[model samples]
Structures are given as structure tokens and as C-alpha cells.
Target: MSVRTIAVKYGVHRGTIPTFVLRSGGKLRSTGLNNERRASAAILYRDGHTLQEVADRLGIDPKTVRNAVVAEGISPRPRGRRPMAI
Candidate 1:
């Protein structure tokens, strides 16, 4: 699939798709340490911490926490408050 298609299907930025495709070519592999970190982030999120909280605790960016959560097949809560009814 094209990068745009993959991005839309996966709900990621189009810019990220190329990097993912390139990484899939075996030029780089995910390490156990990375998996552990992602797991840790997921756990923190599951335990009721917000993404920003998890990121702060992990010393990573909120976007990193969000991506890690999504990579683990978990849907993260929306970031902001609900809109008021008209």
C-alpha cells in the first residue's frame, strides 16, 4: 500500500509510514528494552495515568507514550474534554 493509504489505515502520520516501512526491511529491529519500555508505558496508562503523566514518568514525550500505547493494541483516551452540546 502507498504511504498515504497505510497512514490512513493505521491512523498515523504519513511521514511516519515511510520510516516504518524502512524499518520493516530489517535495517533495524526492535529490542527487548524497547518492548519493556512500551509495556511499562502501557501499564502506567492502564493504571489511570494520563499519557502526559506516563511520558513524564518515563522521560519520554507524550507522543511517544501514545504511540507505544497504540502499538500495544490499546486505544488511548482522547486528550481533551468533551464538547458542550449546542
Candidate 2:
């Protein structure tokens, strides 16, 4: 479980949970996109899906999706809306 979850369950501050974990030699997990999610984000972006679209489909933040696609060596599309072609 995440520290936040534990804190909420036991009524402790989220910050205090991390301190207790460190004192007990427990390691905290690093958050963010994993390899599979990154690959999925990249493929979706390459297939012309907007970052926000991919994020919504994957239930993650758009910035996280953006980072995932970039890490997969895909260049991000230009910002702002694209003009619909005639």
C-alpha cells in the first residue's frame, strides 16, 4: 500500500509515514510510468492520439503520459489545437 493510504487508514500524517518507514529500513516505491505503460503511451501518441486522450484512456495524468511517450523516443506534437484539414 502507498504511504498515503496507510496514513489515511491509521490517521497519521502522510509525511510521518515515510519517516517511520525509513527508521524501520523499509524502502519507498518510486512513483510514475512503468515500462508497459510507457510503451502503450508511445504507441498511442504515434497513432495520432493526443496526450490528454492517452492519459484519459490510461487513467493517468497527461504530463505523465507526455513523459512516457518522450522516454520511448517519440517526439511530442506541437502544442495547441491542430487546424482541421479541409
Candidate 3:
């Protein structure tokens, strides 16, 4: 069906719906504890939570969580950029 039909069936304004669905909001930062998150993520992995799950719970990417698992002695750092002092 066309946009008009979809809008009518869904009870929404077609133009408005398009705006809501395709917005890009830049980067999202996760602010959890580094040591705790790393340890917890490692434990979670050991306890059988998937890397993706650990990443979601700890607010980090799956790859980072996986790295923590792979690095063994290393830890997962909190997700954010270091602030400039200038």
C-alpha cells in the first residue's frame, strides 16, 4: 500500500512517522564502573551469559566485553572519552 493507506490504517500522520523512525542521535556513552564492570563481565562470561548479553548489561560493546574475556588479566574500562583539560 501507499503512504496514505499506511498512515490511515495505523492512525498516524505519515510525515510525522518518518521523522520518528529515522533520527540519528550521535554516539551513546555508557557510564559504569571499570573494575566492577570488567570483573562482572568476566564472571558473567564464566557463568554462561553470552558476550552480547554482558555487553548490554554493562553498557559496553560486545567486542569490548569479548576483549576483556580474551585478555584474561586485563579489564574493561568505562565507556567514555577522556576530557580535555584546556
Candidate 4:
């Protein structure tokens, strides 16, 4: 049964259903917010957007985007001055 259904049937808050199920040893299936954010950041990065660009697009800090990329096993691009062609 869905959390919304349970919530409606029992007059319980929908957010608390996951906790109740877990306490009862039932597994709750869903992609976590952090994981979803990380995946989104990674995709934007992979699509050639810079960390700051991705951060701006996602309304998060560049440092957070960098951390998300790193946590996803992706190597972050080096910071500092870009080399100019001679």
C-alpha cells in the first residue's frame, strides 16, 4: 500500500509512514534526496557544465556540487587559472 493511502486511511501524517514502516521492519523504497541531487549534479557536470554553472542551475553552492561530483566517484576539475595558448 502507498504511504498516501495509509496516511488517508489512518489519519497519520504521510511523512511519518516511512518511519513507521521501518520500525516495523518493512523496507521503504525510494531514492534519497541527497542521492537524487548528487545524480543531477553529476549529470550536469558530465554534460560539460562547470561546477559553478551546475550549482547556479541547481541553486546550490559550487562547493556542494564539487562534493557531490566527488562522492559519485567522479574526479573534480582542477581549480585556479586556466592555461592560455601561446
RMSD in Å for candidate 1, one decimal?
Answer: 9.8
For residues 11-69, what per-residue lDDT tens digits would candidate 2 score against the true structure?
99999998998899999887778898889988988887888998999999999998998
lDDT for residue 47 in candidate 1, whole number 0-100: 74
Per-candidate clash tally: 0, 0, 0, 0
Question: Comparing 1 and 2 by TM-score, which wins?
Answer: 2
Error of 3 at 69 (Å): 0.8
> Which residue runs of candidate 4 sit more than 4 Å off their true CA positions?
1-33, 80-86
The sequence of per-residue lDDT tens digits that candidate 1 reaches over residues 5-82 is: 878998999989768778888353342239889999988887778888889999988888989989888888777622
Q: Quote the positional error of residue 2 for candidate 1 in Å.
A: 27
lDDT (Cα, tens digit) per residue for candidate 3, span 1-86: 54567689899998855555456643333333476666787888766577777888888888888777766664444444222345
Top TM-score: which candidate number? 2
CA error at residue 39 for candidate 4, angstroms: 0.4
RMSD (Å) of each candidate, 1 decimal: 9.8, 4.3, 14.4, 8.4
lDDT value for candidate 1? 0.79
In candidate 4, position 60 carries an lDDT of 81
Report the C-alpha displacement of residue 30, candidate 1, in angstroms.
9.1
Model 4's TM-score against the true structure: 0.53
| Runs of candidate 2 exceeding 4 Å displacement | 1-20, 24-29, 81-86
Q: Candidates 1 and 4: which is better by TM-score?
A: 1
